[model samples]
Target: MSGDARGLWVTFEGGDGSGKTTQAELLRAWCEDEGHRVVRTREPGGTDVGQTIRELVLHHRGDIGPRAEALLFAADRSHHVAALVAPALARGEVVIQDRYLDSSVAYQGAARSLGAEEVRELSLWATGGALPDVTVLLDLDPVAARARLDADDKPFDRLEAEKSDFHARVRDAYLALADADPERFLVLDATASAEDLAARIRERVAPLL
Candidate 1:
């Protein structure tokens, strides 16, 4: 890792069942094996306060407006950064987060009909303008992604139960984010096998490694 950059912050993002967690773990292991200090965490719950917000955001059955959800995610993100992210980065560790600000932009902003640019601005404010060094977005077909979720044993959360069209919009938003930031966004095709997906991510991380 470059000393000047301090630490490399990487985030994995995607819709439900997009294999982000598995891939994040794989990358973390790889980074550690290469002797880089690593800190693995997740958004919506990287800290105690964030986890509380996660439960409400993920499972709450009552109606929540787009702006409200976006702010909640931002609140969780702010706590996550204060409690974990910034300190890890200052120490020069490789910090891999399962999800992050991009999730709010895609799900709440694009999927829920809020504007994408506004969501990005909110994310900047929430995180104190800190952005990931790189973001890996698992680009999966909405139908296949939903099917994978159905096969999982975990109960579906409110967001998971959303209609296909909603998820499709979210997926589009993710792609748009990648397109807007080619230097730091890696779009992995979700159709790839796990092994292939990992390899693709390795390729993307090679420069930083």
Candidate 2:
């Protein structure tokens, strides 16, 4: 990548209702306020085609096998990386992806029994090895996360409605990723107040800027 390529790539990751989205938005707004160019996007739906795939992957109640779901997510990532994510990064925009390859590795690999290495290989291939420079994982208890989701009135999607055990495994995978790459992954507790959490994110990201 060129020295002047789009801004640093940061990704938010965690189990559902772990405040990744909330923190991502806060970070994006803060960056914009600081006069930094920022691009906020998400995997499986950063582009039109990817959005279609996202609908199928998240909202659809159909029973898709583990491998099938993995492939579909990969397909969405391919399009998202090529058409949306990569281009933004190339332009030197700070790209904030809501969820990226880590989500796939944790959900499909750890939770669904696909194997983490296999998921990593697929993600590298799909995104052309476009790993995020900084990954912030909002660590939260699985039960707490599900309770937060349940409190919302929106209909739970297929993945959202998964059992607590599955989410616990997913959380473990996230922790493993952070442990495996301490230099790149920043694991933060999710039980903190939103403002405090956002302040932590700002502190962690400010030095990178």
Candidate 3:
């Protein structure tokens, strides 16, 4: 948002099975159809370097200390913001990213017992205080989220495999973030139908466009 480009940065935040990707894709397609260039990306794997970092942090077999894991995510975030996210916006494209600093704040800071404020500060420092124009939080119960994941038949990543309590804490942290910044966040219930959710997201994004 702070970047000096005539573009918009929209990010999605939620639990593992919260349908963030689906909604983001929907928005991207709608934007493209409206003649707006759109880039759909995700944290931890938004770039080639980020993909490697994602494997180490989310798919590695061995146990990684909590601090090390947090630092790894921060590292990937730093590179992603500089390499992919910033340039996309600079080109006047609509960047609908799946996650941003909020994920690190929720997963590492709140769920992992690292302070959210500190984690946020770490990311801000890394990115020179870059922030999204708008962030959409798809709210859902972690239990429901887990059930949706179970239905996918795909392997759970490291964080997705965590206990329900961990995810619950993550959700709480996400809601708290939205509550703290109502003007910057558009909170939506993930329980709604995908089409319905997509419509609501479009409604919120229309103004920015």
Candidate 4:
């Protein structure tokens, strides 16, 4: 691992059921295997405070306005960074995170028709401009992703239950974000085998370690 006092931070992002969690776990395990301290977490629920917010944002059966939804996610992120993310990094542990700031940018800003830049700016401000060293984006077809989610026999969360059109917009927004920051993102096709995707991600991360 690099000798920097702060640990390397990596984020996994994608649309619903696009395998962000799977990829994040793989990276976490790999970092552990390599003898680096690994701290694994996910946005919207990375901290105890974030858990309450996560339930409200993702499962509450009510209409949340676009602006309100965006702010809720940002609020969770702010708490997450202060309570979990920043401390882990300061300890020099590799922080593997699922669904970071880009998620709010894609889901709320793009999919919900709020301005993408404004939402991103809100997140940046919340985190004091903290960005992952690498962002792995799993690009999957919305239909196929939905099918994968269905096979799990788990009820979809509010975002997952959204119409395919909304998911498509979220997908496009993620791709755009990756394209705009090619140096910081590794965009991968989600249809690839999980093993293959994990290997590719590990390969990309090896240099940093």
The model with the greatest TM-score is 3
Predicted candidate 1 versus true structure: per-residue lDDT over 24-46, tens digit per residue: 99999899989999999998888
Q: Of the pair 3 and 4, which is ahead by lDDT?
A: 3
The 10-residue segment with the lowest total lDDT in model 1: 1-10
lDDT of 4 by residue, 1-209 (tens): 12433788899999988999988988888889899999889988988889999999989998888899899999999888878888888888788889898999999999998989999999999988888888999999999999999999998898999999999999999999999999889999999999999999999999987
2 against 3, candidate with superior TM-score: 3
lDDT of 2 by residue, 1-209 (tens): 22445568899999999988889999999999999889899987888998899899888876899999999999888788788777887777888889988999999999999999998899889867777878999999999998898788788888888898999999999999999999889899999999999998889889877
Best-first order by TM-score: 3, 4, 2, 1
- lDDT of all predictions, in order shown? 0.88, 0.88, 0.92, 0.90
Pitting candidate 1 against candidate 4, the one with the higher lDDT is: 4
Estimate, for each residue in 59-111, the C-alpha lDDT of model 3 and write its tens digit. 99999998899899889989999998888888988999989999999999999
Off by over 4 Å in 3: none
Error of 1 at 64 (Å): 2.3
Cα deviation at 131, candidate 3, in Å, is: 0.6
